[model samples]
Target: MGERYLKSVRLLAECLQGFERFVAEPVRRHGLTHPQFDIIATLGNTPGMTYKELGERTLITKGTLTGVIDRLEQKGLVERARNCDDKRSFLVRLTAEGDTLFRNVFPAVVAHGKQLFADYGDGDFEQLDHALRRLRTRLDTPGLVTPGGHVPADEG
Candidate 1:
């Protein structure tokens, strides 16, 4: 059982690495890193999330989030405004340019994700999606125990 578990872990790691590489190619062509894209996508949906919220939503560290936000702000893809409730914190929102870029690129992103799992039939996709959702819910549940006895925020 231990050997089997180890093999499964190794396989999952390889799969994740491969998926990252595959997605990285297109994101690079769009002139954005994975973290940059994540921030933009989040801002697109949420509109006004503070840096701390972005870090939580993207599962990025505070240090890394600052760099990502700085780069995007430099590119005019996002803006930092003072949060009304907390003057000390800045809320992030996508610029008009950022919205345009997202609109143009998101369709391709969706297609690329679909193509990645295209080998799986509809039934397989449904089953995999269901299993992944269950796993995600369990992992996200507060105080829920993992094999390591701690449920991490970035379970990925």
Candidate 2:
């Protein structure tokens, strides 16, 4: 079981790394890092979100989010405004330039990414999606498996 688990985890990580590498080219061509692109994509069509919301939406960690936003601000691609509802926190939104970039780059990157999975049929996609979701749910559930890989027996 442990060996199988290790193999599955390794495959998952390799797949993610491959996908990132494949998609990162277009993002880099547009002068953005993966996390920067993530932030721009998240804030693209909306009115903006609080830093907390932005942090939640993007894959970036809280420690890294501020720095990414700071870089985007310096690039004149995004702006931060005082949230009317919460004076203490700020709302982040894309600038006109950033929106334009998102409109152009997002679709292009997505199209490029689509090529990677062009061979996958509808059934393949459905199966992959279902399996991934099931794995995610199991991982998210608490106390299903302990750190040592033992399932706790219920105490009556």
Taking every candidate in turn, the Cα RMSD to the unseen true structure, in Å, is 4.3, 3.8
Q: Residue by residue across 32-134, what tens digits does model 1's lDDT show?
A: 9988988877777566788888888899999888888899989999998988888899988999999887876666676787787868998997987896688
Regions of model 1 farther than 4 Å from truth: 137-156
Could you estimate the TM-score for every candidate?
A: 0.79, 0.87
Badly placed stretches (over 4 Å) of model 2 are: 144-156
Model 2, residue 129: displacement in angstroms?
Answer: 0.4
108: Cα error in model 2, Å: 1.1
Top-scoring candidate (lDDT): 2
Per-residue CA lDDT of model 2 for 57-120, tens digit only, reads 7756778898999999999999999988879999899999999999999999999999989999
- Provide the overall lDDT of each model, using Cα atoms, as 2-decimal numbers: 0.82, 0.90
